[model samples]
Target: MESDKIETESLLENLCVGLPTIALKADIPTPKWNTLNPYFGAEDITEIVDWPEFNYNTIIHRYGGILNSKKIDCVDFSAPWMHTEVWHKSQLDTRLDELVRPHIIRTLRAAFEELEPQTQQLNLNPVTFGHGTTAITIGLFWPDTSFTTVAEGYAQGKNRAPGVLGISPKWSSEWRHSKFSNDQHHFQYNQTLAELNFYMDGHGARCGYVLTDAELVVVKRLDTNGRLAVSAPIPWKTGGNGQLSVRLGLWYLGMLAAEEENWAL
Candidate 1:
């Protein structure tokens, strides 16, 4: 037991050192569709003329209209369009597709690469979440074999089921019941850490922890609607102080893992 505790503490210290500090900036600009001359007809332009600036949600919504609306004819559209039996499909302008999507993807890829050690060190694949102009989603990766261990560690931390580690299990349950009970796919990944932060923020408490073989996973919930989030693993080290502090979620998971060896004993 003594050796196990020492090992856990040392691991915690390593994680504290591994966690990278990120500089948050609002840089990605929303896509502006109205600027396209022939793609948007005069009437379509008039509808969005009052919009002060481009927004991802707005652009996506309008783009969906172009794809789904029977009223929109490809004659006036500049981009290449294909006529499907159900709807008109067109490739987005290179300015919108390449400039906007690739930029966000690259930015996120770079940030994650910087924060997470190469998979050779941890044997995990990074998975991203969230949607919008900003890279506002947490990325998590773990080896398949370690899932139960991590889940159990999280359960031990709270002396309860692992469900509580979720952003808002109750709210998620309610939402599932009200809207997604019949749709299994809908319930899969709809909940975001940002939503959890919104509901729990004012209570002076938040849950931010998940067990990892590497000792810790640092996650940040940046927005209420789950538009922005970040996460990365903190690898373990030996003979180091475990006096490091972390956000609520990661702290809880770390506490659980600190007692992990005891679970086997």
Candidate 2:
């Protein structure tokens, strides 16, 4: 475990070199959406597309440099929302895919090509909901499995095998009524939730990234209303007890992996 600290610290330092420093600003007001204009207007598209840092070359260059030549594929687990049944049955005929698919695709491609030039494919799983809990569960509970296996399993809606860490909002609710609700496992569950809350609150609605040999899956957080939460790239702590530092997107995945090991044995 001590070696893990040394290695992650070295990795964090290397990744942070020459990277832009951005801190999450606290108590910033979330932007209000105009329901009268149900669709994103020109200004909305311009704001995202014209953002230079999120452009193709810059994102690819940054993550590629961090991985140091590791071949990578990029996956988006949020694609399911594109074909959501409610949107298909809506009176306005509004399609969520029409709103942001282009921008999302562009960013995903930039990350894919930059991370793994040899693999030119971007995998899209249209079945997985990919909320924060699902993403963290995959990373923490199944660290040894390849990314492809996990992605495909989620896409097919397979239950995780036994003796693995599995907790969802519903599971949390059920546990609250069970006898073991006040026990040690419950304490760990609360700890995990606290950490997630810290990530979201402290980082101000940023996305999560799980980097693996086979793929890098980006997990975007949505507000209670199912709208995309505004996010910025901020530096955040990766290890519990505030030990290692990394960019916010990478930090959640690293934290899950670290804690999984920390709690083992």
Q: What TM-score does model 1 achieve against the real structure?
A: 0.20
lDDT of 2 by residue, 1-265 (tens): 3453322232223333222112222332333111122221212211111112332234334443544443223322334344333311121112212322232333333334443443323222222122233323422222211111133453332222111111122113222223564464344333332333234322233333322111122333344222222222222223222222222233223222222122111
Clashing pairs in 1: 136-227, 136-228, 136-229, 137-229, 207-249, 208-248, 208-249, 208-250, 209-249, 209-250
Judge candidate 1 against the unseen true structure and give its global Cα lDDT, from 0 to 1. 0.25
Q: What's the TM-score of every candidate structure?
A: 0.20, 0.21
What pairs collide in candidate 2?
Answer: none
Model 2 alpha-carbon drift over 4 Å, by segment: 1-109, 118-129, 132-154, 157-247, 251-265
Question: Which candidate ranks first by lDDT, i.e. highest?
Answer: 2
- Residue 91 alpha-carbon offset, candidate 1, angstroms: 50
Look at candidate 1 and tell me the lDDT of residue 190.
29
Steric clash count of candidate 1? 10
lDDT of 1 at 212: 23
